[model samples]
Target: MEHIPHGSPDDPNPLRRLSLEQLRRRTSIKWRAYPEDVLPLWVAEMDVPLAGPVARAVTDAVALGDTGYPAGTGYAEALASFASERWGWDTLAVERTRLVSDVMTGVVEVLKLITSPGDAVVVNCPVYQPFYLFVEHMGRRIVEAPLDERARIDPGGLEDAFRRAVRGGHRAVYLLCSPHNPTGTVHTTGELAAVAALAARHGVRVVADEIHAPVVSRSARFVPYLSVAGAESGFSLMSASKAWNLAGLKAALVTAGPAAAGDLARMPPEVGHGPSHLGVIAHTAAYRDGGDWLDALLGGLDENRSLLAALLAEHLPGVRHLPGEGTYLAWLDFRALGLGDDPAAVLLERGRVALHPGPPCGTGGAGHARLNLATSPGILTEAVRRMAAAL
Candidate 1:
């Protein structure tokens, strides 16, 4: 695929083109979930406009009336190229990759392929809420390895969970949230290496959800779980949905490491039938030609990250906001406010600001809420003020 450069690093912000009114006009879940008077920050959708390349690709496909079932390896090849350029993961085998309807579907399907019903899946708690729900729905037991004091992937805690997950002759699976969700702590190469070793020793298969890897901050570099040593037994779920704001398109890639190729080969043929054809085109364009736009979006999000901290400090000093190294999500600890566990409900009803409740995210989430930071500074400031006033 040919890639066209959209802008340079010196380019002005491309994400700020849309105004708040323009954003509210969106019919997506993020905008439609709450009343116009309420500020909706509960969902993961970003309030940014589409990258020029992605919009053009989707438009061209529509113009051509080329909306057949998805075909070809364009999405996988584009992702492999992006991984090589961005993360120094040059050994990725595009042929070993598969397509899925989305990240969560890929995770659930891969879990099904590797483990039987009633097997255990280990996840870091206070993690992505869907991890617990999907695993349980798949008839698998949930084993949690809670994050350490600093909200990092705890190596010791992981090994302990792995031991428990594999007990009683159960097939064990580890659902790794790389550059993790909510907390935004990007795992180091050493941490991933330790996880790989532990999973190997405990006979656990590692499936990494790397959808947020592309939006990392300048202060941190994202390391692909499959790129680390001893990670050959793992699988990765990746998509352009989160970073490119293409969630409505519905497409994702499920890549298998060299050692796990045979396991993925067992995936049902119909499993690849759900991805949208336009989604493939848009995702391909984002990976191939949207580099400059991504860089600009990163610049905007980095500013918002700092802006959120300043707003929180001024309006709600008691709230502990840890600026994460990646993702546009902020995990706020509201314990200091003496709010009961899951303060999001209080904020939503009283402050008229919707945030994702924490307790549903499992351990380490009491008295916390996950705030979406991918919005205008004015909106963020207003949300903080409303939250403060709710007190």
Candidate 2:
């Protein structure tokens, strides 16, 4: 197969290049969840065509009838290469990595290995909604360490939660969302190092969800949790799905730090059976050959971030948008609009625009809405206009 040229950063913004009609044709939940009249800027899914390498890799496999159970460590090796070249982290040992169904599934399985049922799991509040749902569903208790007023990790608050979580000699795990969702705050190295120290002191195991690691803009750096000085016992879950827009292809890696390799080794053999063979192929292709495409996408997301801030300031003056350094998600505070806890509900009902409500994101999320900014600029403009109209 001929290699696809990785587009330059100066290329036209991919997000602005797609049409609404083209996006509506997608069968994914992002488009199908809402009626035609309603604009959906809710889900994490991006509105762009598949990267050439990923599309070809999957399509070529289907053409050859290569569908079967996943095998080999190609995915792990590819990720190791990507990590080394991208972040200068040359310590990613492929032997410490295990393939699983997706990031959340990997998180659950890793937590199971480290903590039993009824154990406590700590999380930063106003985080990704699934962190709450998945942890609770796994029969674990959730303790909240709410982010400080600036939406950055509060060392004191985290220490308090860690201290509380391990008070009874109970096992606890701190579920971290790096390059955090909704808020889009890219955790600094100093911030992550502090978290490692706190977790170490409290005997709390850290499991970082780094699915959005590759989506960071040029302005911010994504610090892998396990790379911190005191985090040799931590675990990290990563995948190419989010960056490549391949969520339907369910495959992810659970990487263990040097101290946690034994725990990862103890994960049930059958757990590896969950990932689709095709998903593995697609993800492997993404990590190995999708770098150029990823750079191009990041450029588009950066533009959208600026566009969103300008639009909100001009159209919905009451809305406060703190643009994130990573991910295409925009966490907008609508409390000034006097819309109560869930302004998203009102936006959907009155404005025919859909957004993920802030309350569901946990404490500090009230009166805020999470908007997906991975769409065409036109859609974003219209969504804001409708939101203003509703207000």
Candidate 3:
């Protein structure tokens, strides 16, 4: 790497090369269907290398051969410390913090521990999808409370859902997502507080999935459920895995109120004993020293965001997207394209770009597509180009 003078990177042609191409050339996986050169905008991992701190930690842990059956361990301490340092909130002590195979497992286990069959669990549509499956798989009835057009959470709608559930003699549980998955809407503290009040009134249990809390946008504020006034009486699901792009490492933290945590703790030893030991090393590394890399990565994302907006307008004018306030995911409206109401199939298969269709995200996501901007700028540009050509 040569020392290039630090100057305006906004010049149409920036100094040096983009890491996006490096990742693309390195990726041996065939993303698009045969015969199609794929430009994958799917999966949550960043195309760039892991943060130096996290990288060093993972490497050192590997050197130490820390892999083992991470049943009862220091993993909790690592997660709690991370929470205290980053979020400024004292998460339940490590002893109180339970581990799971990963985030999806935590969400599933939490839902089952509280709600019963036929009970109403409130979910904002176009959710992470696993929530719906978790509820349905657990035999709980789903209370559909969809997000508004802006992708911002609708507290009033949520309260209405809670009110309706209580009246129907159905137990209500809230599956919350902040700095949401596909749409990337970071729920405001006030909105979350309003929802919390409504749920408390209806005796609803709130299971907040805040995995994306760490990558918050510069102008946005992402408040963890437990950080909210009523969160001590709530459930918070978070982990360092998402923030560090270590999802494959497999570990997440689940904390809830006393009674709830105790009840949750006893369900099965398997629930808490499922986290990966490697993930623990990565978690600690990321929380303790990855801030610098994260900031630089965010800067890259900001540029990519601007590039995406400009590129879409100039080339793929048919595709519409909200400058994602937070999260690497970008939600695009593709209805304007001649591809009719939805263009994911046409884009992914015909256009050779893998885009998560919006309908699966829920009603608000309909006629929409979710693009992961976590990759390199060049890759994003190519993705947009391919999508434009397909349209």
As for candidate 3, its clashing pairs are 126-361, 126-362
Error of 1 at 265 (Å): 0.9
Q: How many residue pairs clash in each candidate?
A: 0, 0, 2
Which 10-residue window in model 3 sums to the lowest lDDT?
A: 1-10
Off-target runs (Cα >4 Å) in candidate 1 are 1-11
* lDDT tens readout by residue for model 3, 87-130: 67675555556777777788777767776778887888877767
Candidate 1 or 3, higher TM-score? 1
lDDT of 2 at 145: 97
Q: How many angstroms is residue 143 displaced in model 2 relative to the true structure, after the best TM-score fit? A: 0.5
Per-residue lDDT of candidate 2, residues 1-391 (tens digit): 1121233334455665566767779999999999989989999999888887999999999999999999999999999999988988889999999999999999999988999888999999899999999999999999999998888999999999999998888999999999899899999989999999999988999999999999999998888888889999999999998999989999999999999999999999999999999999999999999888888788878877888888888889888877889888999999988899999999999999999999989999899999998887678778888888788
Clashing pairs in 2: none
> How would you encode candidate 1's per-residue C-alpha lDDT over 1-391 as one tens digit per residue?
1121232324456545656667779999998988988889999999777888999999998999999999999899999899999999998899899999999999989988899999999999889999999989989999999999788988989999999998999999999998899899999999999999999988999999999999999889999999999999899999999999999998999999999999999999899999999998999999999999999889988988998888888889999977899988999999999889989999989899999999999998999999998876667777888899899
Question: Which window of 10 residues has the lowest lDDT sum in candidate 2?
Answer: 1-10
TM-score of each: 0.96, 0.96, 0.88
